[model samples]
Target chain A: MSAALEALQQRLGYRFQQASLLARALTHRSHGADHNERLEFLGDAVLNLTISRLLYDRFSGSDEGDLTRVRAHLVREESLHRVALALRLPEVLKLSEGEARGGGAQRPSILADATEALLGAVYLDGGDAAAHALVKQLFGELIDTTTIDNWRKDAKTELQELLQGKRLPVPSYRIVATHGQAHAQTFDVEAAVPALQLSSMGSGRSRRAAEQEAARQLLDKLRAPPAR
Target chain B: MSAALEALQQRLGYRFQQASLLARALTHRSHGADHNERLEFLGDAVLNLTISRLLYDRFSGSDEGDLTRVRAHLVREESLHRVALALRLPEVLKLSEGEARGGGAQRPSILADATEALLGAVYLDGGDAAAHALVKQLFGELIDTTTIDNWRKDAKTELQELLQGKRLPVPSYRIVATHGQAHAQTFDVEAAVPALQLSSMGSGRSRRAAEQEAARQLLDKLRAPPAR
Candidate 1:
């Protein structure tokens, strides 16, 4: 193994029985034909299950919705990227020259996918036991420190659930505009409920966030007392 | 033990060490506050991971997308409901008086959730070995019968993947209209690729199917030669 890979293995706390699997996990799609996409897919399932299991065991009093919310927060791209960064995955990532120049190694989505790929590799190299153990080890602190109370449903989800609970027609969101640079774009979104004759607008760095913001504003409007 | 519970265990092919878990798994939310929701949550993760592992091992040559598509088909509500029906789950299901009178046991969603809950109960009552074995046994035939070639990418997924591969902005789907009776609603969906200045229209019995049909039509347009 190369010095870099050896170091990465140390950080992962896993010695791959087949080092090739580890190598494949680190190879991004931008790098070549054979890459980490499949591994990332597998890793994603594993990560979800691991986190769900952990949450299930830890939060005995919590309902399924509570468990799902906490698990979602734990496994989102931001959280996965943080985990990847903690393992210094960017140092070991294999990217194409173009992607490398484009800072692919530092990209959150890339890092998150690679992290999942690594977990996939771990599962493949050592089976469920190893994969489960590694996930538990890596996420133990996060699980311990995190509380379900800290997880509020994102605006869109909250709105949808609320409407569903009340047997109200679902709200809709649409992107009204997109502008600025590709890397730093802004999206203007509108949230509407035709049944309620209400609409609210919000803008953010991404379409999802913008939609979420719109939902938040719309929810505010929904909850407000009527003006005199 | 009741004869009904015993027969249900016989059908499941595994007797629970903790009968209470089995009882809880059978209980529906409508039954009472203490229900199978938590178990269903845990079981969902277990089912996802189990199917993922199975697919990974079975389809060594399939791409991540293929694996994902197949897994989605395998673990969907319909498939889970089929599995539950095969086990004669309706005969063993526990529902509140109102739900029972409303035919809750025969409901696809309820049957599916109960199936997952049963798997969760098995995991809790036995452990990983037993859970894995049960899932393997339950899904083995279906896994053997289903072919990757038969699992075509749904229109929406195909469109999304194609756009992603081309580094183009993703398409957005909106429900333009929903008509007909509540029990037999028809949804009119529009799929738009704003960057491409293209849109397609489709209508179906459900919003998702309608959106998918619109996407399919759009893809056909994208893939065809320009009309004279």
Candidate 2:
């Protein structure tokens, strides 16, 4: 194995029994047919499972929605890219000459993919324990520093806060319809921001749940870039 | 443990060490404060990882895209609902009185969530080996019966087949733009079915990849319900 790979494994804190896996993990599709895409696919799943397990244990009181959001925040391309930079991935990634010239090594998507591919390679090389341990080493600090309270607020509270920050009147929510028998009714709620001329509808088993869903939808719209 | 739960464990081929986990897994939110959503979240990750690993091993020569499509077909809500029904989940699911009267036990979404919750419960109760074994027992047959040829076709071919099946003309593809240096250019392609007044665009590192993406987008539009 090359000195660079030896150093990378040391930094990753997991040595590969099969060195080829590490080499393949660093190879971009532009470089050759034997690249990291498959490993990336497998690694993405591994990363998700590991993170879910971590958050499940860490924030025992947090609900599924909060856990999902926090997981998303942690695994996004930008977050992965930051981790990749910390590991100095640009020095190791193998790209075609042209791609290299085009700065593929520094690309956020490529860096993020390589990170996942590395996890996948570790899993393939040393099994679940190795991969899980690697994930913790790479991500444990981030999780440790995360404040659950930031993500614990329900959708309605977040949406209201966002609108209030912009000096807009609070949105209004109303029950638009109810289906099924009273005991098992599904409520459909509509939330409208008159100042923004935006409206969204959501349905759930209870009025509050439906309103929260509607507010979440509206928040998504408000945060999204304007459509072309 | 209740006889019904004991029978479920027998059918699932894995008994829980902590029976309360099983009870909580069977409980829907409508039933009370303690519910299955959190477990469902964890189980969804377990299921995806297990299925991805299975496909990775089974289709040694298959590309990542093909593996992804096949896994999706295997783990979709409809597929989970089928497995849940086979396990006779409806007979054991805990639902609110109103939910039971409204047939919540047999609802596809509820059954599917319960199925995932059960897997999560198993993972917590018996660790990875037990959970892995349970997933294989439940889904191994489905994976074995799946013919890769159905999912092996590229998006363009699948779109062509769908259009031909409907007796419509084949779609046309054109390169709308190419960005970056020649050696590392990204292609943007547009695919259109003039007869249906439908079109979609996709961008990728190569023309073939871009066209496949465009076809996939068009296919998604064709299969989706009419927009509200």
Candidate 3:
């Protein structure tokens, strides 16, 4: 365990000033009475603060919605679980005999928790500055490196938020038509603001997809200046 | 505009390789025909990924909820506005005449947007690596610098999300007691989970504040292990 912990420490880029903190971070609730739950709590806050600041500073022009979606994507359960695996966090995680046999280490929720617990350990061992430095080094590379121009666009999230804020009824989407072969299908979607009797049509590979496209078009129309 | 931009550049610790991108980043919609909206979108995604990685690496033991809250607080409207002001962003902002007089330059939304746009500009001016380095340098100092351990306690938001997600009746709060004088009053609150028939109590300085405390207590009860 110590050897694996040492390797994890090397990967984490921070030497724990207090070895006990590191140990606690690795201890899961299933392991015994003592566990990483508290550390998970603290580390969650520390991690969130660091990441929030990074996003805030990096995306100055983005509205709250875009910022939120991107952040959600980055810190989601799946992504965090991937990072945990990349760190080989599961190898050193302490689990009960039952949990270990049940493959708790590979579970997304557990992995995410362990990842957070490690952050708490770093925060406790070295304090906020150390935690911040470590976090920046980890996240900066991925965020700064990736081109995020091509992620899926969700017009529903945008429209729901927009209409809710405006005290307007939420828009609804319906599949108006479908065409072409199954392998090369095309869908015609209609998004309607029922009260306004304004329905816009959009085409895509699936009804849901087409509806989203229609919503985007409708949003543009709604936001456009009124004609003279 | 150049002087102000130069000053901002110096403060953020990056020299834009493509000055045009930087210029576009700073161009607010109100200021001119070309605005920072597009740059804002890209920057938003970049910021989230960067920050997510940072937090993951820094706080190895944190959980999703904890990280989410901390990030939300750090990147919230108010904090970004302060950072924007620190960059003296308002001084060089292009705004429509109406917006200028309405003080849109200093508005929290505008200031936060400009900050993200600046990040996009940095990303474009420099590569992702450069942008990451710049964002990390700028925001690294702000991580977990708050006075209150705000990360541990966002009961109100949590309660709202929980109710919304579970499709349970929204928890309702009522003031159970009040203590102390007007200047230093403390209210005791009871939060009732109607469906669960579970009620918890908490105390705070104001009604809303007390309600949040009660909500926290309620959440704890909900999370408690069931009796065998």
- Candidate 3 residue-wise lDDT, A13-90, digit = tens: 888878888888877777764578767766665666566557666766555456556666766678678778988988
What are the per-residue Cα lDDT tens digits for candidate 1 across A1-228? 999999988888889999989999999876776789889888998898888889998989887877998998999999999999999999999988878878999999999999999999999899888999999988889999998767856778888888888798899888988999999999999999998888999999988889988998987787543331
Cα lDDT tens digits, model 1, B37-82, are 9999989988988898888889988778789989999999999999
lDDT of 1 at B72: 93
Q: Residues B1-228, candidate 3: write the lDDT tens digits.
A: 377778877988887767777777777776664678766665654565456546555655565556656667666668778878888888877767767888888888988888877876776567556767866775677763532245765787788788788889888888988999999999999999889889999999999889988998898777653322
Candidate 1 segments exceeding 4 Å error: A152-228, B154-228
Superposed on the true chain A, the predicted chain A of model 3 yields a TM-score of 0.71
- Model 3 chain B: which ten-residue window has the lowest total lDDT? B144-153
- TM-score of every candidate relative to the true structure: 0.71, 0.72, 0.51
Which stretches of candidate 3 lie above 4 Å from their native place? Answer: A1-25, A29-71, A82-91, A95-107, A116-161, A168-201, A204-212, A223-228, B10-17, B29-75, B96-102, B116-228
Query: Candidate 1 at residue B217, lDDT?
Result: 96
- Of 2 and 3, the candidate ranking higher by DockQ: 2
Q: What share of the true interface contacts does candidate 2 keep?
A: 0.45
- For all candidates in order, the CA lDDT equals 0.89, 0.91, 0.74
Which of 1 and 2 is ahead in lDDT?
Answer: 2
Docking class of 2: incorrect
Arrange candidates by TM-score, descending: 2, 1, 3
